[model samples]
Target: MKFSTYFNDWLYGQDGYYTKYRTIGKGGDFYTAVSTSKFFGGSIGNKAISTIQSGFLPSDTTIVEVGAHHGYLLADMIEFIYTLQPQLLDTLTFAIVERFPHLQEQQKKYFKESFGDAVKLIHYNNISEIKLDSAFIVANEIFDAFEAELVYTTQEGIRKNVVVTNHQLGFEPCDDLFLNAICDKYGIRQGEIALGYETFAQNLAQNIKKFEFITFDYGEKYPRNDFSTRIYYKHKVFPLFQEELNLNELFGKSDITYDVNFMHLIDSFNQAKIKNVSYQTQLKALVEFGIITLLEILKEKAGESAYLREVQKVKTLLEPTGMGDRFKVAIFRKESHA
Candidate 1:
């Protein structure tokens, strides 16, 4: 079947891919930071709090989170903010923009149980509907979901690869104007193939007027010494699935994701004129924002020897060569005119 057909069939509404993956777990298809540990959420909460306290607050200031899978991070933010300043929690408005209805329903259920009507949960199917203005937008593991167009460079010129045969899943080269435009913008010459993440990044950045944007994912900048793309499957990196992994199989049926292009993201932000850009690994951002302090709180709450072991596991998440380094944090802040 064609990709569009397959995607439509497997990912329609409640009876499709969204519901299928909702049941995933330890032995199931995939896992994210939220699935791994609450520490990730705690660390993000710390950053959000710091951002809010550091002069980004307006009377209408809001926290807009994209890809709020299972509302784990939202719950952490609400709980952490309540602990820090209960008054602010009352003023805080939480908006969750999710694509899938089933996931949005899950978010509603979780928020209703956690905060009742105190937290405002706004669900959206498209990013275009997200209104900006003094909002902090957080997207964890969200960039890789943007559909990428494949391109290959040849001795003659550049060629765009389009799926030609569905049964064999064969790719054929064609001349696509949009792909050519992207190649020109990125200065990709002959004999080079690249993903279209840069274009997606640029589109996302251009849509927002005023907001603090941060993306957490595993990806590298362009002009890499390594020629291979970074893709993960089943909590492990596999080479064979790097280029040909199907989106339906990767996200809907399994836990697979590609590393984002951090340099491209930075460049896109620059082109969009969004200022105060900062890039760090997730671990560094966490430590700089006081994740250790949160762990101490967790330790105090547990007061058990086993909790120390859990702390060690969480510490490993911050190691430079581990998830801490693999996962990056990119932030862009829009200054207010008033």
Candidate 2:
């Protein structure tokens, strides 16, 4: 089986480890900016409200969150809108586009306790199923957890990597249109090109009819030095499954994600007729989204003693070498103007 197949199965399969694991936060494999600080989600909310005030997206536009991870981000967003733009809440729709069984349970509980009937839980198995006509779609750390097609480029030529045996995964020469397409698109050099993101982006584009789509992920639009699949368990790198040593990590019990290429994403969206694109670092995006003001509000609510803690929370999301520098935010406006 291919790595994507194995990966999809390991994470979402009925017998998958994610079904039994809480693989997020300080206690889990890794912490996302959303999980690290509630401010991250609140900042997203502020961005949404600002966009609405500026008429980027209509007030009645649906806010669809893809792969929301227990709906924590949406919770923050709902609370922000309630506290600041409560009237907008009545007109707007909060839709959580999710599929994971384990996450759904947690999301349902969170919604019940936090948001009540404010959110519309859309049950979707595929990303395509979660469609929108006019909305603002927030996909935080979404693109990274996707199927990546690994290609090996040698002096001879490009070759697609595949699983040959249980012991080792091997490479097959690039002779097909798929390899040619990727080579033409990304201008692959004599190194390695792992792309399956193109298809993923293209598929997502179809579902987005008209929206301000924002993606937060790690990696560049241009290919740099990236050649490894990451698996984290308890905040450490969990070794990939092998036939030799006993990799105790349960199948899909950890977080398996790869770097995202925003270049590939932009091309895909443009090809699909989505226009008006811009990119920025997470720090910049949050800054532009008014993270400082949001932090002050948090500080006031949490108290001065807790305010410093809130400042650190904001810093964690904005610091270099941590999430700030590593994480990138790409905003694609389907329309050039309101």
Specify the highest-TM-score model's number: 2
- lDDT for 331 in candidate 2 is 90
If scored against the real structure, what TM-score would every candidate get?
0.80, 0.88
lDDT of each: 0.63, 0.72
lDDT of 1 by residue, 263-332 (tens): 6567656765676367888888878768788878877887768578767767656888768888888888
Question: Model 2 clash pairs?
Answer: 221-263
Root-mean-square deviation per candidate: 4.2, 3.1
lDDT of 1: 0.63
List, residue by residue over 269-326, the lDDT tens digit for candidate 2: 7776676367988989999888899878867787888878888778988998678888
